[model samples]
Target: MFTAGHLAANPLPPGIVGALGLGGYQLLADIAGVGAGRLGSQAFLLVAADPDPALPDAGTQISLHQTRLRDESEAAAYVQLAAQLGYLRLSGYRLAPDRHGLRSRINLVNPATGAIAATIPDRAGGRLLRGGPGASQLLVTAGALPPAG
Candidate 1:
């Protein structure tokens, strides 16, 4: 169950919700963990319940796992490695870079409809933006992350 206090205690970084445009979804779970490394970076796993537009009673769930990196350069390196390993080619996903080339993301396209089903941003500043159904239209609205302090 989601609660106001829980969200207040573990709030998502600014612009995350608007970036993903998760307006209608309901928060289900939020888990934070330590990244595997000497730095012991922070990581988070978020699960949300997404209501299906076609079927009122039927719904789906989406999850996003974000890791806090040391900096934008480190995050870019991680995305590059993932792409080199052909991880982005799985399931008909194509790698797309933002206009500024600061971020790279994998977009999953539906074969039948050719509509984007999901988007996974593997970019700088330690954000892993994952999107589910109805995300295709919103991705264009996602702006760059704020400068790291």
Candidate 2:
């Protein structure tokens, strides 16, 4: 998980902002074009209720995801990564389809279906890098796939 600091900086699509009505909610992460599919793809403005410690799985049960777009691709992801002037700016991987994988400080395949690898998270570990009055943070969780029989 990553902290999205530019939620309010970029101009989000009007219809989406209205649909989620996240105006007063606690924004967790704001993803730009991280998802994809046959029809199209989109971005996300993740929000959630206050963190709940009562949940299971290493206090990670409490998470947030708000889909914001469709038809997203490596190119779009690259654009988002490049366009951002924040910590995640240098993440753009040259927009090459052959090497089109999502990356953060930690190296992992982009979870997007059409990403570098269309693999799903099977297991993992995570840590809270930061929690503040402002500035979203990138959290880490460790996981891997099981052995095939």
Candidate 3:
């Protein structure tokens, strides 16, 4: 289970509750390796819960619902996403995990401008960022790594 940090428990909004009742949205996570070169490991953080189906579709809709989601679980998801973004900003990899392997092309975009701030490219192309303590916000999925040499 993913950590919620300091988020407190609260009642969820009607829209989210209804959507959950209807069934939709899924909580997922991608874990990255901590080593360098070919000596690294990776994992995933996936939740059985899903997002509210009635919840908005576009970024604008999600923005609107952000203010409405008071439930601890819903708010936690936002925090987790934000943490993941922060992790990417620092010295970590941003992974999009699948059934067999992790994805390399992951772009952390500004939800507001849709402008690409930090771009993580495929194993053959991009380089990972580096930072100090507190740099790692939340553990992220493993960006596609080059094959073992």
Candidate 4:
């Protein structure tokens, strides 16, 4: 489970605002990413299951943990991480036969409002990747909105 504070530290794209329940987990939003006319707060509910190297356990159950991305630089870093995690779905890893490098499809919606916000190519088999010093962070930017017209 993730708190809003955690999201604030990382990020949920720009319009997602933050995540609530990841399937069943309840997420809390902490006021950490809101400041100086910027959206900087977020919290996600995730479960981290123990990884079984034996037969590919195949799932994770993250607990309530917190990490912060205070400034835009940090936020950009997060975005970069997301991009590296093959989030964009457009220019990442190459699928099987289409090794020519085609973009995947990505779509993030507000489950509450039934609204579609972000859309990118989709990955053949999209799954959450691990995070670490040289890993891509799965910062969901689903509900965020574009600047005013």
Candidate 5:
């Protein structure tokens, strides 16, 4: 359940039906925690979903046909790989959530030079802009916090 503030912080592309799903969310979390992919919300990462003959009774994987995927880990991996393979042009987010809520790393891309940079937008405020000198993005992932002393 996304809150109003979260929604405001991270606006979705107009007419994009459905949410980023739990699997997608988990993938983003893993990315932030493990540094698997770059993260950003500044630009949309183009993704397309396809069927994997591995899920059991995975309940209609129709949304995948166009990357309008449901919350599934397999789908997330597939998309992530696609992004990396250049099958999809990803200039944003090596580690960003499907939606915004807590802080998450955002991959900021310099469109003009095709360069990429990472930014922790204070709290995943949706903008992937480089935080002025020394500023950083903070992400809250499941069990990512250190044990309190």
Candidate 6:
């Protein structure tokens, strides 16, 4: 998980950010990435997985690229570009102001199919539930993620 403090402490190189299609955004917690270790391949994959307490050994795993953006409009453009570049699994949250108040939401986009997997309002004490193709349902919460066992 890469938090804002972590980023501030050890900033990522501009090249990495650009390569990941994560420019103009701030990274938050609950982040994970995978590289072709020892496979002699340059492909990298970033993803997040949440286990469902109701079903042991079953949960959803989606490509995770958590970011804090200004609004959905800005995020749409980034997501589109990332998808076009073959970023099949990209997900993040957006925080924007509204007349009622501040609005926050999470979006999971399957860039490969050009479809939105899920969208949930970002709020404290809430859970974002999702299931990948042929995978069990997963539970994601707005609160701090449970310590990995």
What is each predicted model's overall lDDT from 0 to 1?
0.31, 0.25, 0.28, 0.28, 0.27, 0.28
**Which segments of model 5 are wrong by more than 4 Å?**
1-11, 18-73, 87-149
Best by lDDT: 1
Encode model 2's per-residue lDDT on 1-149: one tens digit a residue. 32444343433345434544434333223443222111122222221112236743111111112133223343243233223312222243111111112211112233233233222121111224632211122121111211111
The window of 10 residues in a row where model 4 has the poorest summed lDDT is 91-100
* Deviation in Å, model 6, residue 37 alpha carbon: 30
Residue 102, model 5, lDDT: 22
lDDT of 2: 0.25
The TM-score of candidate 3 is 0.23
At residue 100, what lDDT does model 1 achieve? 18
- Assess every candidate by TM-score: 0.24, 0.24, 0.23, 0.22, 0.18, 0.24
Q: Model 3 — which ten-residue stretch has the worst lDDT? A: 34-43
Error of 4 at 137 (Å): 11
Candidate with more favorable, higher TM-score: 3 or 5: 3
The lDDT, on a scale of 0 to 1, for candidate 4 is 0.28
Model 4 over residues 1-149: C-alpha lDDT tens digits? 32345333543332222332222222232222211112233221221222246755322222212233334454443344333322222222221111112221323333344444443331211223733321123344321333212
lDDT of 2 at 11: 37
Model 6 steric clash total: 1
Candidate 3 wrong stretches, greater than 4 Å = 1-102, 124-149
User: For model 3, what is the alpha-carbon lDDT of residue 62?
Assistant: 16
Output the lDDT of residue 126, model 4.
23
In terms of TM-score, how similar is model 1 to the real structure?
A: 0.24
Supply candidate 2's per-residue lDDT for 26: 33
lDDT of 5 at 1: 21
lDDT of 6 by residue, 31-126 (tens): 222111111111112222222466453111113222332344433333332232222222332211111122223354443443445543322221
lDDT, model 1, position 36: 11
